[model samples]
Target: EAAVTQSPRNKVTVTGGNVTLSCRQTNSHNYMYWYRQDTGHGLRLIHYSYGAGNLQIGDVPDGYKATRTTQEDFFLLLELASPSQTSLYFCASSDGDNQDTQYFGPGTRLLVL
Candidate 1:
């Protein structure tokens, strides 16, 4: 299993801020997933990809943009962030199409004031 990690474990910003959350996988996984967890809601998919330079929109992608720069690098971009977008973000990697065994990283907590 690949080890996934995210940068800036915690962040604080104002409404309309610009933020970028980065995720990297140690092993070369074919698929990567990004999701967010809110106070009372289950994990909601934000974006994902199968490989470098490829992006697949997830369930809650309206306020987020994701990019796969390399096989091991995936980034989530919030150009004009909002208070509603503040949440705990996660990154995961899977070697196969099945999402059942994806490896997750320690989450990135974002706070929008």
Candidate 2:
């Protein structure tokens, strides 16, 4: 089955810090995305790409960046992050089709203090 998951299920950091969270997929898919989940809010897309070496900014791209290093690996980068950036991050992947269903990861919990 096609699946996507993230690492470091929880994390804590201070203001103005750098954090890197990773995601991986086993579906051999060509589309990947990173989104943040917050209370009383819909999932906000941060970044996504069709394949490795390609990235497209989404709705909430500020203070966050992402990279698709390989077909099965993607990473999110938060540099000089702020408390506002603290939220649950989820990774997802699709089969590179417009109507393809997306598989979501468990998510990574981040806290900035």
Candidate 3:
């Protein structure tokens, strides 16, 4: 079974603060993604990478950045974070095959005050 894990399950930050969310997948998936969850917006993709050193920005790219270090690891960076960015962030991984399915982590709740 595919497994995904995230660190610092919860966070609180002031406006203009910075935060980095970490994710690791044990399924050795080739595709990884970062998403933020909020009311009215549902789950929106922030960034994704097909492989190491390859990143693709999602629809919402104003204040988010992402990096894929390896097949099993991905990171999301929130620089100059703001109160509006407070929400639950999720990391997901998939094999990108016909029978593959994306597996998501528990999620990190970030509160920007």
When sorted by TM-score, best at the front, the candidate numbers are 2, 1, 3
Off by over 4 Å in 1: none
Candidate 3 structure quality by residue, lDDT tens digits, 3-111:
9999879999999898999999998789998999998889999999889889998988789888888888899988888998899999999998858888999999999
lDDT of 2 by residue, 1-113 (tens): 68887998998999999999999999899999999999888799999999999999999999988999999999999998799988999999999878999999999999999
The TM-score of predicted model 3 comes to 0.94
Looking at candidate 3, the ten consecutive residues that score lowest on lDDT are 93-102
> Which regions of candidate 2 deviate over 4 angstroms?
none
Q: Of models 2 and 3, which has the larger TM-score? A: 2
The global C-alpha lDDT for each of the candidates, from Candidate 1 onward, is 0.93, 0.93, 0.91
**Model 1 agreement with the true structure over 1-113: per-residue lDDT tens digits:** 56899998999999999999999999888899999998688899999999999999999899899999999999999999999988999999998766458999999999999
Q: What are the clashing pairs of model 1?
A: none
TM-score of each: 0.95, 0.97, 0.94
